[model samples]
Target: MSGYFVTKGSKFKGRPLTTLPVVLNQDLSRIINSNLQLKSSHDLEHLRSVAQQTDEWTKLTVRIREAAEASQSEH
Candidate 1:
């Protein structure tokens, strides 16, 4: 009935546009904290490490993509 809804009979419903960014950011923070063991999102050393280590960068990118895909599929 509302603008957020796809249709009365639709199986998938629309979510607030702002939700994706919030979810993605939370996912990013979780990955950085738990996987990368970084204290701050702005850690320069982590950035340097990612830049220097191809494997680390690849892993990070894969995790981010997975998280984004999962979030999108949910909506």
Candidate 2:
């Protein structure tokens, strides 16, 4: 699924922060986007480990992580 990240603060907040759109497999997308709360960072890490089992998903996750770091630096 494709998604955009919206800035939370004021001053052009509604604009998308990252230029690239995220594309995830249906199962992965469902798990990540689900309402269920991850209990802790370890849970998230475990999820990432599972997703990284596929080479395509591993690359996508790296790109997503880099984009997120870049966006954070901009603020």
Candidate 3:
């Protein structure tokens, strides 16, 4: 069995192994391309707005902590 890397730069067997030719999902290429596409100003502004909003940040932190606790409990 072989493990896949979330990143392309991952190496294996002391070689620069990146993508696996077989068992490759076609959607994986699309996903990479979509991620590579530059984000628009609207997206940046939205992220900035979320960061600027203290209430939102606090809510997000609380939610993240809740998720962490839930995952730990599931283990």
**Alpha-carbon local distance difference test for all models:** 0.57, 0.47, 0.44
lDDT for predicted candidate 2 compared with the true structure: 0.47
Leading candidate by lDDT? 1
Provide the TM-score for each candidate, comma-separated: 0.47, 0.32, 0.40
Best by TM-score: 1
Point out where model 3 deviates above 4 Å.
Answer: 1-45
11 in model 3: Cα distance from truth in Å? 11
User: Which ten residues in a row are the worst by lDDT in model 1?
Assistant: 1-10
Residue pairs with clashing backbones, model 1: none
Model 2 lDDT tens row, 1-75: 111233446665575444322233222333433432233455455556667779856765665566566667989
Return the number of clashes found in candidate 2: 0
Model 1 lDDT tens row, 25-47: 46666453455433344443565
CA RMSD, predictions in order: 12.5, 12.5, 12.4
lDDT per residue for candidate 3 within 7-45, as digits (tens), equals 448355675444432212222223322221113444434
